[model samples]
Target: MAAGPGRYSKRVRRQQDILQILAQEPTMRVKALAARLEVTTETIRRDLEELAEQGLISRTYGGAMLRAEAEPALSQRERELVKEREAIARSAFRQCAHGKTFMIGSGATTAILAKRLAFELRNVTVIAHSFAVAMALAQNPTIRIIMAPGIYHAGEGAMHGAQTIRFLQDYAADWAILGASALSPDGPSDALFEAADVYGTMLRQASHNMIVADHSKFDRMATARYAQWSEIETLVSDRRPEGPLMRALERREVQFILAEG
Candidate 1:
């Protein structure tokens, strides 16, 4: 078992305290951290140095910033926030009425929705670009899966290219159930600019749009826009939004659904 703060080494305790502070505040000055942790400034500096060397944080001018990049990729996302995504997907799945046809997009949250639709729902046709989405539904013979042809993107677990965009342009769906790498009141955006055109085309071709994303993506930035707030019919997520994004959703009259986390 891991030792308590008193039983463990001071170095371990101090580092844990440092991470807790950083979690509340993205950046912290060494002097402030020292005072908060009731440690000498020199000790705080050493801790910061060790954390930086371990890539836990980034050293700044007289301070350290949280190393957001230290967080792992999609699989890491699935592992860390899997429950939240699963709950959000469950809430989003309620909209997936049996016999409804939709074009589902690639993303971790959407991947969860794919599993639910595959096992829990029936007789649904899904046009998707994600290999993950396709494979998730592969076991169910009742669910028809249509793959959009394109160059496979290993990192995204999906396919995308000019061909994918062309196919999306030619196709239409009852709804475009999508996901975003980042989102704001400005609407949903994609981190993969190469596939942004394909997402945009898919969005336009669909009669209605639903976005399933977690609150962590609320204010995050991405390269290209997929759909505007006005374009989306519903927003499904783990938590209700805050700040400017919240106001925008209200003004647009978008139906926002919160899933239990």
Candidate 2:
């Protein structure tokens, strides 16, 4: 028996309705979906197959599930290093003066300092390449936030490009708080070439360069060097080195501020 045009149209509508429902609550079984849509189990299977092919869901043995979201969360790293980050942030804030313009680079520690500065400091201008830092300071009316425009890097939550460098050239800050992937007696290190260029520009535009890092970052080296030891005025770290490395920094006149744990 041939199905009427109206009946065929209604079936197509039912399939779309089922797909929408599954999209909202994606772990529904075929039998459950059939019952909800008042359709047979075979019809539910066909709908699931169609949706799965469109990259919306995955077909399990008895059910369908939504595709997982792709962004990584900071919860794991934050939980493990909360104490270290807090100590670094507190020490970094001390270097900042009221009514001074500052530039903060991207990193977990610097991001925390941005939030702290927004609340603790008054009438300050903050220039940052970090989206996270900008968002943190956006709520404070007293602190003016200027974001450097460029290509956004999701991992660092910062923008980087030739435009970013050009924008930074126009203004000089009283101080710049920066983060490094690694730090040795030789200098601050970074893994990306573009990041190195941006950091270099920030250092050139600032009067004083302060580095914020945790204990683990010391004595480590990455692919590129951003700043030499003499360029850094103060080192704000959670841990202070002893022995020969400490002596090396002292000979270079690099002031180290060990944050209280």
Candidate 3:
């Protein structure tokens, strides 16, 4: 059967979905993809083979992975993960309902949450470091937007560096709504050093921290560690994580929420 607005077959639609998943996380196990897509392992294997032949993915022992540099650029990443991020953001946004002020960071996921606040949230103040986020909240009449001082990194669509940390240090917020460049069992992280520093400050400056990441973030990797699993009060994602990662989050007492599409 065809899916979405386009007349796409089962195979083509599945392949398209696979690319979006790969855009978020470079690697994907065949079994996991099969479960998520509601297909058999053999079917996923066949799809992987086709994608590999087309130079879209490289096959692994039981799965496939995108080349490190093959990950989508900032704009592309946002476009591909639209549905997942929307779901994740909706859940994360609800958590900040009781708070009067927030410390929101950058990224596609954060941007979605920003839009919700601009349209729906009332009488709130936001301390933000991302230009994209600021623009979104500007549409609302009540929410106050504070831009953190720093060098704006256009590539990340956010601000970072020593100045940002210094600026964030001067204030405390009720909640910090943030995103990860990549997430692993180690916790949430970003590949950029400056971003890591800014997020680290955001984590401490807020009394509560809620992480919004799509499930694909689990298979992604990044160098700069921003917070430990225990440090996160809640994690909202498009899908539930696998067993070990789920267990780890539970052990750390992080409230994990799977946002439905």
| CA RMSD of all predictions | 8.3, 16.4, 9.6
Q: Which candidate number has the best lDDT?
A: 3
Off by over 4 Å in 2: 1-79
Pick out the ten consecutive residues of candidate 3 with the lowest summed lDDT.
65-74
Per model, state how many residue pairs clash: 0, 0, 0
In order, the Cα lDDT scores of the candidates are 0.79, 0.77, 0.81
**Per-residue C-alpha lDDT of model 1 across residues 1-261, encoded as one tens digit per residue:** 885777458788789889888766655689999899898999899899998888776676687765533223555566667889899988888875543778988888888889988888678788999888898888789988999999988778788999898887777888888888766556777777865777787778888788998877775446566778888889999988875578879999999999975
Return whichever of 2 and 3 wins on lDDT.
3
Best-to-worst ranking by TM-score: 3, 1, 2
lDDT of 3 at 147: 94
Task: Write down the TM-score of every candidate.
Answer: 0.72, 0.69, 0.73
Candidate 3 lDDT over 90-139, as tens digits, reads 78878877888899988888988999888788889999998888988999
Q: Which window of 10 residues has the lowest lDDT sum in candidate 2?
A: 68-77
What ranges in model 1 sit over 4 Å off? 1-72
Q: Per-residue lDDT tens digits of candidate 2, residues 39-99?
A: 8999888878886777655565587654432223333334556789989899878877553
